[model samples]
Target: MDRFELFHLGWDDLWASQLAESSHAGRLGRISRVERGECDVLIEMGRVRAQSDSQRAQSAVAPVTGDWVTVTENDDGESMIEMVLERRTELVRRDPGERETQQPLSANVDVVFLVHGFDRPFRAGKLERFLVLAWNAGATPVVVLTKSDLARSEQRNELPAVVAAVAPGVEVVVSSIESREGLDRIEELLTPHRTGTMLGESGAGKSSLVNALLNTEVQETQEVRRSDAKGRHTTITRDLLVLPGSGILIDTPGIRAVGLWDAQDALENVFSDILDTAADCKFRDCAHDAEPACAVRDAVEDDRIDFRRLERFRAMAAELHESEQRVIERDRSSRSGRSHNGGKRRR
Candidate 1:
């Protein structure tokens, strides 16, 4: 194994220790792209196609791009992913097809770029949801507003402040491929040995940003529709690329359906002002809706919190509660079915 590739790909002693403890006797490789039945894994010998039967492996989820896995050869001499090392961080969202299932987007992600374009109206709900996703993954989130050349002068000066209000304490960088504004700031966020990925809907200029960061036009670029400013899905799969003299970057397909899974603490992080104000509420479990002595409501009246933002937070919290209830019910039913298979124990 070349020592440089390990560190270059963000592998360290922690991952080394995990590989040492694995029962499978094979080398470590990172999954660059996950296909239907196979994965493109980067090993010392370079990228190779390996069959994946790892959905039931130790990780218990199908390996996604950026997962460091153990690759072993089978009796037929075909490389197989025997196990996926315990992940350090994972970008996850609820499966669009399954109600209660979680879909792991990327494994071991260090930074998540929440890309948006100035061509379209700013969507705070989408930004908040993406923030929750990044926070839940234990990754730093950066709001990258692209197409600076096209933004009106007011948007250039005033839009960033508006975005800053939505993403408090998160870095917001305005970038343009033509003008090359704020590109250096975005590049500096990813130091060597870190892995970052971008998330946004179609026509958000995510791939263009990736091309800029890579210093070459590797990703295909497209123009958005004039009427709606919506772009087609140009980038289809997720692939990891090492930046020149910098860190590793994983580019993913446009994510239009960003269904949040289990993200209570992350949601709190997104609306930290609300969380802090709720701390002073008269009741510990105050819902802040018409509740007497509600510090949150008081703050809204005092202009400390925007009423619309408060309403959005309330709606998201209610949705999260519903999701929790569904999870508990599903777990109880699964347990009941298991007990019927001769392992029944009466309380």
Candidate 2:
């Protein structure tokens, strides 16, 4: 029945409604970092380490950074996470090296920063995957071109064009941690009580950007290899940190493999123009490869859609299809196994 400090941690009326209707009784808090079996939760009393095993009773899903949860004490006098509130948005991807598994990177993210370093090559395929991942999470995608200070004249101009091609109607900003250029554009989008996250490969500038915005050494920065420009993973785990008068920012570790997870609708949104042209193909199921009257291929040939753009679109679509097939196969096999075991699943 007492008041709680929820404004600084991205709480709003919607969350309050959920809290009022929640079946648990404890102090409301937001998860800052998740560890082995416990997590650091920021509560009305401040940050406290709480046992998270209590979460499994109410929700089957494990806790992640940026989750709003309730804390209570058990008979042993240890802080415990009672329950986790429903999430608004989640940045998800197919688990690395797993066919039909999903890895939730961050929860309740309002904005997703597609951070890429201008110092390295802008791999269109990799960046497009990031776009699809962000879009599928229903977050506002912003292309943040970091390390602009090291980029040459041509590199600076060329990178934005590629971003525009892959992500239409999305905002793009060129930024540098040293010069502090274009940081304001990214800051204006971080309104109070909102949540955003920075996602990119390790060698990219995600950690450096987080340190700059937070004005502290919240995350460590490492140098990339001179030969390959591959950076080490400085951020081992994801954590939700608060900004001064701004919203919360989730800094995640470098993601190497970005496979899709239920992103078919998002793929269409990203490449609607190309799919629209495919409507005129000779066959309804036309693959657009050497097919007669293929409007999609014609669009590429006539310079309507960039060649690489079309290629990335097709590649992502294929990946989604393969993911669907794997899910089906896994489910069928699971059903068969259960049937053989007399309707009981095996260990």
lDDT of each: 0.87, 0.85
Give the TM-scores of the predictions, in the order they appear. 0.93, 0.93
Root-mean-square deviation of Cα positions for candidate 2 versus the true structure, in angstroms? 3.0
Point to the candidate with the largest lDDT. 1
Q: Write the per-residue lDDT of candidate 2 for residues 1-347, one digit (tens) a residue.
A: 22236787888899999889979888889998998968888887778888887536653567789888988888888898888898899888898867689988778989999899887777877877888889899898899999899999998888898788777898999999999998777777888667889889998988888788888887888999898789888888898888776778898898876889999998988888888998999899988888889999898889998888888888889989998998999999999887889845553
What lDDT does candidate 1 reach at residue 248? 82
Q: What's the lDDT of the predicted structure labeled candidate 2?
A: 0.85
